[model samples]
Target: MEFLDLQLVHALKTDGRAPLRRIASVLGVSDQMVARRYARLRETAGLRVVGRLNPRPVGQTVWALRLQCVPSAALGLARALARREDTRWVKLAAGGTEVVCHLAVRGERERDALLMGRIPASRAVTSVTAHRLLRLFKGGPTGWDGIASVLTPEQRDALAPAYPPPDARAQPVRLTDLDHLLLTALARDGRTTHAALAAEARCHESTVRRRIAHLRGAGALFFVLDIDERSLGGPSATALWLSVRPARLAAAGAELARHPEVAYAAATTGRTNLLATVLCRDDEQLYDYLAERIGALPGVDTVETAPIVRTLKRTGSVARDHDPADGAPRR
Candidate 1:
């Protein structure tokens, strides 16, 4: 990817709904050029700008699950998990036998049933470790600041969403069967227009517009930007397991979230309360981050780092050897 590619991603990470013309104006490029670059990136990189729901604020729960399976079954199982709407993030880890993913459920009962019933019964799964996510330090569109240097503050402000205060988050929404249809469409493409959604949901266009706005304002939906890290010239991603003192967990988490290297970080229930994904240019830079940054943080008792070998699935896009000429991930 070029400098312009990174700028376009940064702008979209701020606002997935921002018009192409607006993005072009902010970047000092023609709308057609911006559109062409986006098309190329999506075509070559398996990029996805998706509308995702933030479950936490809506009385929902998220659990980080690591499934250890036979190496032969790992990719297929990961694909199955990725296809499920309830399973948000799924990745085949560096240790080829393990598949790491998040299960976002609406209620405690649903979360319990999934862990105790369906997963354990799977013949391919040898072991299951579920960690309840207690708090989110990052891991959403708003937290991806890795491209911060590419956009000016003024440009960024123009695309950012209005983040209401913690106390102001909307309550869990009551869903009609039809609401699920609207959400399914949004999940695939957040930028899917209202008229299209109405046609799909078999509802009036005004109803589509009202429902979408309500969901957005109700904290039931949010936008996330996903792009190929290989194309960005920085492909290495690491998952860090951190043990922190109970008293200082919040402080340590907040501090860790401030670092641009962190793509996803959260407090979970397990021996390691903190799990984070760190993005770096290479091994040397990763060493620096783990040492000078994470190691320097107060109350961090211990840390274990695992480099992600390849991402099998991101938010909504699965990794394939898209650039078939070389038979490799797009880069």
Candidate 2:
């Protein structure tokens, strides 16, 4: 990616809905230049800004599933899972023998139907492990650390989103039918014009605009950028599962989230309580990270590294009419 492309991404990460004019002002470039760069990035680099539902704020449960499938069934099963709206980050790991994804469900009944009834009954799945996400130290709405540091502090501050206070966040915001439709359209393209959203939602443009602002302010909605990491020049991507002392789990996870290599970090329930994905420039850098950085972390007992072979899905939920090349929901 060009230096300017990287900066634009960082700005979007800060606030995905920021106007191109505002982004250009922060980057000290012409608004047309920013627009051209964004369009080119989307066309060539597979860049997508998607509005995603924040499950936590809505009383939903999040679980990570690692399914060891028969080698022949791996790709098929990964694609099937990716097609589900409940699954995200679907990947083929452990040399294409494992399908891993994050599952979000509304309640125990919904969770049980998938985790207990459906998944366990699959004949092709050799083994399966489910980990409940207890806390997220990074990723999700926090964004990844890879392109996070590209923008200057002043630039970031200029684009950072204004979130509601804790008191407001504590109350779950009920979503309307229109809200769901609006979000569905935005999921396909976060920068979709307000008029387009209104047409999709079958409502007035002003109403669509107000509802979007309300959802964002209520913490029910947030934006995520899904991009081709290859453009960022990373040669290695590995998933790390760590067993850390309970007393130090939070601290360890927090510290790990700060590392530039970590794309996602969270605390989960299972034998390995912490999970993280790290991207390195090369194998040598990966070794240095494992040997020095991880080795220096406190209270981390054991580390399990699984090299990511391929990603079937990344940041967006797969809509019914999904585009094959990218994970975009059909408009």
TM-score of each: 0.89, 0.91
* lDDT by candidate, in order shown: 0.78, 0.82
Q: How far does residue 174 in candidate 1 sit from its true spot (Å)? A: 2.1
Give the CA lDDT, 0 to 100, for residue 21 in model 2: 99
| Model 1 lDDT per residue over 187-270, tens place | 778778888888998889999888777777776777887776766676588888899999999998898889988888899999
Give each prediction's root-mean-square deviation over alpha carbons: 2.9, 3.6
Top of the candidates by lDDT: 2
> Which parts of model 2 are misplaced by more than 4 Å?
145-148, 164-169, 317-331
Those runs of model 1 whose alpha carbons end farther than 4 Å from true positions after fitting are: 162-170, 320-331
Sequence-dependent TM-score of model 2: 0.91
| Candidate of highest TM-score | 2
Candidate 1 achieves a global lDDT of 0.78
For candidate 1, the TM-score is 0.89
True lDDT of residue 234, candidate 2: 59
